[model samples]
Target chain A: MMKYYFSTEKMSVGYHGQPLIENIEIALDKGEILTLVGPNGAGKSTVLKSIARQLSLIGGTVCLDGKDVEKMSGTQLSQNMAVVLTEKLRTELMTCEDVAASGRYPYTGRFGILSDADRLAVREVMELVRVTDLKDQDFTRISDGQRQRVMLARALCQAPQILILDEPTSYLDVRYKLEFLSLLQELCRKKGLTVIMSLHELEFAARISDKILCLNGKYMERFGSPEEIFTPGYLSHLFSIETGSYDEENGTMELEPAGGEPKVFVIAGGGTGRNVYRRLQRQGIPFVTGILFSNDLDYPVARALAAEVIEAEAFEPITQTCLERAKKRLVECERVICCKDSFGTFDRANEELLAYAKHIKPQLIVQTNFEVIELDQKEQNKSQEQKDHDKFNSVTQKSKVENQNQTHNVRKEGIAPINQKR
Target chain B: MQHRRKMRYTAAFLLLGIGVLAAVALNVCIGTVEIPLADILSSLRGQTIQNERILWDIRLPRTLAALILGGALALAGYLLQTFFHNPIAGPFVLGISSGAKMAVALVMVFLMGRAVRVSSTAMIAAAFLGAMLSMGFVLVMSRKVEQMSMLIVSGVMIGYICSAITELVVTFASDAQIVNLHNWSRGSFSGMTWEQVQVMAGVVAVTSAVVFLLSKPLGAYQLGEAYARNMGVNIRLLRALLVVLSSFLSACIVAFAGPVSFVGIAVPHLVKSLLGTAKPILMIPACFLGGSVFCLFCDLLSRILFAPTELSISTVTAIFGAPVVLWVMIRRRQERTA
Candidate 1:
């Protein structure tokens, strides 16, 4: 068997006379992917930075391969270890390949030129990251997810025995998040590199990491596996939330909403209707919407999407036929909401549609105000009448501004609070 | 691979072509007589003695001075940029130039007192001493501060205090001595002799070579001080050595050309943009070549933009350089948003 590598003792790290993380001991055999999981501000990054020598230890020794880290010269240390940071790479104008090639700097000559071996290492890592095609692209111009992979390639090119990363998944979308963690996992296994990383995603950390280190509630919680660390008891206390369920298989925490449900009926036109429709669905509540102009984006979106909606006019005002159909549905809806008018003007039938919801005593959410409703009334009566753009602007735009602020009020009714994880 | 190598060769040839053209333009178009290029060429061929005194004795030296100063400042800027990982950083960020100016200032105020008598070599030596002294302080501070931002703040502090000291020195200088000091400080190549140009060229040439050799290590610096060390770079020693070499380059130029601005700060950015990469291997040469071209262009502009009365080289660079810097800032902001 290859000789094992381990951090010899419990070491505390501090900066400027204050300890960041203390009495923490971690050891790894070759090929172990150690994941540090914690809530925000848990000093996971400090631990990595300290071991990578980005930060000096306030106390204790960090021995790598049985050698004291502090005793090695910079070049010697670099030869032994590498780090990838959560912070975005700040450089501009370099190609992906160029950035990766910089990893060979420590191994190169006095002038730091790359040898053939250095070039090979850079190319190999680029291929490994599936970014061989992106090698020529400007690093700064690339997408955030691509940039993160490029950073990994750069780190790998250094060929360090130990690799440290801080929150590699923090900025990634879900798909990219899974992909990045998987890539890291692959790197550790294939290279037999001792990998250490800090991450915020609990489920992914639990699923992929070989060992999990939890920094939370002012204590270092070490677990041999993700199952041991991601318990409901551990997570609820960690986040200081009243109710949270840890989905062990998927590694997601389901939060209990703060307030009771709000009864909402939506009157929507165009696509302005989708957000409210989904919020209601996630809240486990029901809603009714209608007199949707058939050409409206919201009509199709709601039909194809969730929630019960009644349609009236395809290209014209809501007819009596559409309203009658919607009224039958409205018998069940507790409140009515109109997404802000796509066009300010409404037909006479839409006015009656609004009046029907008003008569039913359901809370009315109007996308527009009464002037457009009045113009539609005249159209229904076959009267020659006109309204200025300004009249429509005031009628349609003003109430909607008030309606936006009302969304906050609805949140207090606790339909669905804004998701803060993203 | 062969085709790419050929294309790179072609590109290099084009850059050299531009550099040579700019050199000639700056040469024939500057000085009191403002000799024509044809006359300059003829004089080189030994056909124009009437203009030889102006061309060979004055204009030639000035042109060479511009080339040396430009190349040196640009390389210094590139080194400092990579060293700090701050694009705004330059040779002057650590008050290296001001420190050099202070040394010259002290020499003038005390040793050469109103005489305007010191040789070009002595002034260069004094400036070198001053720049090196300030760089010494920065190197010490870099060892103490783990963060580059803090190190930059310390440099700014050093620069500010040095400027104050220079102001005090100026307050007591005689008018004639002040005139010499002001002209030197604002940057001028007017009276540069072959001897002075040779000295400046030697320093720039040697230092550029040293820096070019160190380009790979410097590239590692872009990843960061920590990462660089992890890769087996003796970062502490390399950083100190590079700082010293860069300070030496900047100081020699200051001694010869006065502290010409922007060439050290702006040229590296322009070169990086033009080359389309920040790979130090290419960037160092690009900076050197581009710096010389840029400064020579500024020198030419200073002479011709307003005929008879010349502007300072630093002033001309500021006029051109500020826009590039503003564009960089705006580009960075837009990038952050996206």
Candidate 2:
């Protein structure tokens, strides 16, 4: 039988008489998969090493099964808890069977001769980790993932009640990552090994961990079920990124750009519009791309994905023929998104096209500096650049402009729309 | 499984064969009156031979003495390294060699010049006694210092103190006694007799058997002290037994050849590199052969390098030993960083 509960008082740890991390209080129960999720240098590994008695606690006590952990001998501590460190073991020339047999250290007597019972225990644990077939091979020659499984097998040979792992999935690929988690889950469910691990992936931890310990600055920022700790506000604070929103029904966070969706009317050329097209499709926003010559990379991506495109002739300038089609499409769209290179040059005919859009004043969402369009005589004649740059300089000034000149109902999430400016 | 066992057997036989051939060649070739191999072989076959004095008196005793000392020092190095889990640890790490040198210095410089004229055998016994006494002090101190590095440092301090005492004693010695002491410090097997060989071989053979039986526990020790204890090994008993065994081995070799430096440190490392492991079963015999082979080669170099007026064997060994140690240290650092 294993004793699970300890005091909730925080503990302090140090190495070689110098303090490392402190004020960390945690309570672990049997049959629980608790994960410590933090970025590098957040001291997640320090906490685990302190619990396993691999490192000394400088100030506070670590009571295991209601007794001071420091008082117990190595054999006793090893029997209660096993540790899997991140070191790539260089103990080659030993077979897998030999490596696992070392876990019976506390049980064997002075001569190190194995008893029948010890041999049986080693075999059973080898089978448990499903590494029995690779038992005969030299440990070094095996793949890293297989070697990790072998290490887990050795830990199980100790028959430890608590298994502590540090970055167990760090070297694994996507497929192995899922399989490893499932294996740990099965072990926790069936054998009641109190599993504690650290992870880098947020999605994997949210899916598998029973309790998540989110470490940020010095203390744990949040410690609870994954649903409570993985909200938009908490994630935004943790990662310090701009876009963070959660979908309660899907149990996933939606990280879209600030100011909801821009009602973009994309004026893309060649296949420059493909990425924006798929991004809008996944985001479930309205958009249009085109004036694509017949054989542009963007034209096929837009066409194949059922995006409405205004097609034009291959290698042709933005003539009146293509402009008439684009003008017709631009009226229905709320904004115009153009790639910087859509127009061939500063031709007089393309200059007329820019004048027409300036007259309507749609929200033009372009990827690059549209010098051909911005430097057109028609846009300069309107003097829109100075007003546009000045109006976006401050939220207070933009809001005043938006309130005074409310001609469009664009419903932008956090920005002043083009038509709303006087 | 049978093939592995067979290969091990073949290796053991090969080591023994090479040891015997080298022992005969080195014994025959190196002496003031260099006996030919044919005459040496004939004398052994009980045929009346020329150069009988050279074959029996001068060469035979010295070569046998070298073999015994070489094998014992190597075995001692093997046991100490395995027990400590540190590749560089040696029997001399406990300062036993310095202690023995101190005792020999006291006998030659202080006692022998006065009314007490100690025999060579008595001086050998005195050196052996001094080494055991130092080992006893280290054993007592090891109980207090829980850390391995601290214990090693304590041993180093003991060596330093003992060397200081020896140097102080040397300041008052007569010139003849000083010359003898200088020769002893250089670690030679030149004037050894069959009587000394008879004494050393008995002690070495018995201790080797004991170390062979203790190999399994020593293997567990290479993992670590805590790991060895968890494996049900009695750490206290094994540590005491290993100390006594290695001390006896070191004492016996120092008694015969006067504390040859490199064999006790380098032989075990050479064996481990060859076997690519720390397992004692393979390491023990490999160390035994490698030690003998290394010492014999050093002995040969000492005689030939400066020929008729031979340089000390210790000088030759140090010339070779220092560089090898540096290389191993550099390689270990590279391994750790890698």
Candidate 3:
């Protein structure tokens, strides 16, 4: 409803006169990045393609700077907007430089010949995206990450008022993905270049986008800032994620937790129990882990992978009632595993819970970095003087219980002694 | 890299220009009555040399016809290639020429039977209609099958059907009419008149100029329809222009020379490789020159190869062009796999 640099007014788009998604309202001001996020086949691309005028709009209008997009002449529209498409750019005998130079199409002469200024613009954009070294290479010969950068360079050289991209980071590696997005963010901030794109990587999308549009069936389901759009249970519902859970605030995904538990109780606090919880999940051990504070670093992972997470309120001290509840859960477990060897003032509750597990004495293990400590209670109680520390040196503190039965093949310095590199 | 490309463009143009001059001279001089270059020049200056009539009336007209028609065919091929985004699309391959040939054959038969004369304009109109008909089928097939090879297969099928129909029409003609239709149907450059040469030159000149003006948009189109549209190319309008301009050029060629084969497909591919770029600004003129050179050589070869019995222009062109087509296909497959 608010006027912006680019806006779609009740636009309906589809194939063969059918409306796949209708009444889509999106408004982006200058120097903004709007990202579309949705499950596959939810018509994210259709909405994007329609916005770029690559697909004819089925109904309503798209406005660029208060001008009806469909009514603008080719030159008028092209100078204002450019798109990086998902379609494979099938080209022959074209260098990366040539592809980049083609971004000047709207400003070029009658024959699309680039003048010195246009050539300089191309070079500048290629440099801006750090693909200057690849300018002379054949576009199709480069790696996909390099190709994505080159494509970005091409779109940038257009000097458009609005840039539209579809899954721009889909082909990029992690390093380039961050670099590419930061470059776009820089353009938006420094040059006031507005960008609208779809991103499959929700993490990057959450970090980079100024506004996010959530799409599901039939329409734009939710549209707002990333803070508003990435609320709890939304992406799981939107993506129809049945087996796994998504951490909305952080945009991290976790596989479904093992069910029907009570074999192991893990006393984990701070960030120590994350790996142990995941390891137990992978082994299908169905462990219950907690007395984790709601704001603890491992609470989310425990919530995702643990059978039961005995949670405490954030910043709260160890209360007698919560400890009693934890003790009750630990009694039903066959064995107790403590992921941390030491607990400080903040995690003193975890230390107290670990002591209680040993006092009850069902079966207990103290977990450390790649080490699991097992106490044989009868032998230790019988000869505390002789067993002096239950501390016989066995060389490597092997977590053999976690290992699936393998004979030690060590010769010297733990090498199996293969002859050749091949 | 830019300077190297500039050098390649200059070299390609020079090469094509020299080839065109050599082929023209060879075609003009090495006919059945071997006219020397000096005598041919003198004949052009109205000196009335002994072999002047043969040089002027038969050799010169035929040579010019081959040059003009060849260029038109190649330019048409370039336009169609741009339109379809397929390197293999061309007038002859897509059955457009054969379609035109059929219409011309029908007109020739009906007019000759009625004891009436057919003007070059009337022949061109008929050819244009038939070309559009075949192009319609090709366009429909292109929409139905997104695969590039399937489009070519459908075009080739359309060509076969049109050729069959043309042959059927030729069978009903009188014995005298049969000889004329038979020679034209085989695709020859013989019996071309100066009037016919002038008309084709006029048509090709106008269409090629229009195509040259369209070079900027056509360059955008090379990236694909979506990008082209994003770049503010009026895709529908550009596509329509390519179809009309290409069909007109092919119509002009078929009206005069009766469906010369393979020059359309081969010349544009050859020129693009030579220039090392598909930038339409350079490609348009280069394709025209390359087509002229290709056709001139083929036309000249058709005359001298069998001596007293002249070969069809299609036969000589097919001998060279088909291999290039096969090479393009093989290379396309390799690139796709890679």
lDDT of 3 by residue, A147-233 (tens): 888888888777889999999999788998888899899999999999999999999999999999988957889999999989998
lDDT of candidate 2 over A115-185, digit per residue (tens): 89998999898888888998878776677788778878877888887788888888988887887888889
Better of 1 and 2 by lDDT: 1
Q: What is the descending lDDT order?
A: 3, 1, 2
Tell me how far the alpha carbon of residue A85 in candidate 3 is from the true structure, in angstroms, after superposition: 1.1
Q: Which candidate wins on lDDT?
A: 3
Off by over 4 Å in 3: A1-3, A362-422
> In model 3, what lDDT does residue B288 have?
92
What is the docking quality class of candidate 2? incorrect
Error of 2 at B17 (Å): 8.0
lDDT, candidate 2, B1-338, per-residue tens? 42574476567648755875776597567655666777777778999887887767767777777777787888987776665555565656668877888887886666776758666567667777888888878778777887767777887788788878877777667777777777776688778777777878788888888887787777766655644544445678999898778877887776556667767777777666666555566667767777777777777777667768777877877787767667767877775575
RMSD of 3: 6.6
TM-score winner among the candidates?
A: 3
Give residue B239's error in model 1 in angstroms. 4.0
Residue-level lDDT for A24 in candidate 3? 93
- How well is each residue in A318-375 modelled by candidate 1, as lDDT tens digits? 5667778776765444345554433455555555666776655433333333211111
In order of appearance, the predictions have TM-scores of 0.70, 0.62, 0.91
* Selected candidate, larger TM-score, 2 vs 3: 3
Cα deviation of B17 in candidate 1 (Å)? 5.3
